[model samples]
Target chain A: MSTIGYKDWNVDLADVGAIYPFQGWEVAMTIVGVIFWLGWHIFQVKRESAHLEKAKQLGDHDKVHQTLERY
Target chain B: MEGNLNALTTVFTEFYYWVTVVFMFLIHVGFCMYEVAASRSRNHMHTLMKNVMIIPLVTVTFFFFGWWIYWAFPMFPFFGGLDLEAGAANLPWAETMGTNSSDRITGVFWAAFLLFSWTAASIVSGAVIERIRSSALWVHAVLIGSVFWIIDAAWGWHYGGWMVKYLGYHDAYASGVIHAIAGGYALGVIMVLGPRIGKFAPDGTPRDIPPHNPWLLAIGIFLIYTGFWGFYAACNVPIIAPEVIGGQITGITWTATNIYLAPTTLSAITFNFLMSLSGGLMAAYLVSKGDAFWTFSGGLAGIITASAGNDLYHPIQAMLVGAVGVVIVYKLHFWVEKKFKLDDAVGAVAVHGYSGVVGLIIAGFLLWGAPSSPFEGYATITPWGQAVGAVIMFFVLGFLPGWGVSKLQSKLGVLRIPEEVELQGLDYAEHHAYEDAKAEIIEADKAHLAARAT
Candidate 1:
């Protein structure tokens, strides 16, 4: 029932292989990880686009110019 | 002093811990910067000083008693009597406590533990910024850094700790021993000390008191992350042979081990650390809708959540654990703040304390029935044990002592700054001489300019 597969450390160290949790779920974890990575890119693009659109609507030209100058 | 190989191992271990101590100092640096950034400009110097002074105060007090408590109190009271035999060697008058050639490892090892003490105290320092009096906070620092946290460390972090033997409490990197306890301690104090005057609205709605300098706060958290890498390494014995451990393990192989002499690896923790950090950052960004402070803090909370099991967890488990922990912690922080009317100035209680309790319970399920120690006769890791351990850490050792002491301090009218002083700002009230001097100098310069013009 142990997630790391070993219930105890009584076995010899030489016989030990992987000791991480969920030994057979490497492929599933990889898929989950890929989804998170790809999803982040999608979300980030949408967020940036929304921010830029809002920025475009701002009427404070002088403030915008001042910010650019400061940058 | 011994065989050449033994001597080299001893010296190398000493130097290894010394390096980690240096690296861990950044945690305090980060704490000071973070506290100052969180406090308003009027309270900036007071906030910085309050954190900075914990280093020296905790250091001196730790040297006097904290190190001894770690050695002597591992199984004290509940399990057995004080380990006077072990305690004698760590006492302030002991040869090992000094620069004795026979004890090459003691000084550096003590320094490493002392740095942890600083961190425990500093965690509390952040939560009570702006409102707490310097003298009162210093007393709390010594209590947390030198007394209470060390007692818990003796009971759990020590190799012969009762929790390990009796309950299979396996906090490999001090999720409970350090973070949970410190967070709980902070919560206890803040509950008594109360929030900043304007932290809540007239109707008891919690207001978001943003950090005055977000950029500085970001840098501070970044430094804390860097120090955390060293903290992880410090929690491990860099190298040990099976024979040296004298446990169930039988082999010629040398390996890194967690504090309890269980085999783990730097490589393993490294993978989990980065993965968990990434998970926390991503989750926080999504959950907080890219709130910069929560995002930065989420990375921290994520590592803390995975830390208890990082020694054995897969990188993906670490990541998922971190992500889930962040979401829970984020929600809990607000719920507790709103429900209890408690103000945690820097989210210390949630990020460190609640995350620690969650990590411990998660480790219990994930590492269930696993060996808590390489030593025989130790209880196996279990959910019930971990849950109980979390309560003991966050409630008994962390909150109880903190609450009792703070209540006493509050009764004596010394726990918090005066209301007048609080409204005027701590720096202006306490360090008025410095302000007066600055004003006088400015006035003199203006007068000189007028005279020159005449």
Candidate 2:
């Protein structure tokens, strides 16, 4: 009934393999990880787009000139 | 000093821990950078020095009595008397504590624990910056670093600890023993120390005291992440035979074991660590609406949240636990700030303390009916046992002593710098000699330039 498939640490080490919990769900976990990775790109793209749009709206010619000169 | 196999294993284990100790030093460097970045320019020197001094102070005091406390206080005053047999070998004057060819392991092992001691004290250091007196904070450092946290380690993290034996207290990576207790200790000190002068509006709304240098802050946290990888490695027994464990484990096979000597794998913790870090980063970005600092800190919070069961968790389970803990800790940080008008300068209480308590209770349910140790006659992991263990860590050992000592310091007028000093800055106030010397040197340079011109 243990999630990791062993109820205790009594097994011989030579016989044990893949001691992580839910040992048989490698594909499912991979799928979840992939989804998470893709989702991050989507979130970052949307957030950055919105941010750049707002920055574009705040265009002040004198301030822009001052920023360039400072740099 | 023995057969080839035994000698090889001993030297290998010694080298492994020595590397982790070197890696863990980066954690302190990160703390210094993070704290200095969080503070204003006026408080920069003070903040850096405050954390930098923790190294020598904690290292010396830990040598004097802290190592002995870990071996001596595992069951003291509760289940049994002092463990003098265990304590004898760890005393400051013990031959093994010094350079000895017969014992290659003690130095590296003591250093590993000593680094953890610095972290516990440094966690407190961040929360009370700018306003606390150096003398006061140093006293708190020695207590938390050399006295309190080690006691909790003996009770929970040690292989034969009483909490592990009776309460099924399973903090595989010190979610409770180090993070929770240090967070609670920070909370206690700040309750009396109060906020930096301008941290609140007169109307009682909270004001954000953003870090002066976000780049340094980011770099600091990144270094901490790097050091944390070594911390995870240090928490395990690199290799051990079943016979060496002498528990219920059978056969001649060797394996890696957790601090409590229960079987685990380095591969398993590695999977959980990266997954949990990712989960935290994503959740923090979403919850904090892409605030850079919180996003970085979220990754750390995520790992702390999952660290309790990282050794045993499915990678996916670790990810979700970390994500959930980040959201809760983020919300709680602001809620406690506004409601109580208490300023935790760097959010230490929520990130470390609250996350630790949350992680411990969650582990109780997730790891229920599981064995807490390989040794026989120990209680199995259960919700009630973990809940009680969390209480002992957060409130009993951590908060009470911190608050009591701070209150005494406050009464003696030694806990905080004066109001005038607070406004002018601790650097200018306490280290006037350096400022005076700088002014004198500049004047002399100006006089030399005038004479040359003439």
**lDDT at position B404, candidate 2:** 94
Overall lDDT per candidate, in order of appearance: 0.92, 0.91
How high is the DockQ of candidate 1? 0.64
Query: How accurate locally is residue B291 in candidate 2, as Cα lDDT from 0 to 100?
Result: 93
Please give the TM-score that candidate 1 achieves against the real structure: 0.95
Model 1: lDDT to the true structure: 0.92
> Candidate 2, which segments miss by more than 4 Å at Cα?
A25-55, A59-70, B430-435, B449-454
Candidate 2's residue-wise lDDT over A1-71, tens digit each? 55556667777777877666566788987797788768878988898899889888857889999999999
CA lDDT, candidate 2, residue B374: 90
TM-score of the candidate numbered 2? 0.95
User: In model 1, which runs have C-alpha deviations exceeding 4 angstroms?
Assistant: A44-71, B429-432, B439-454
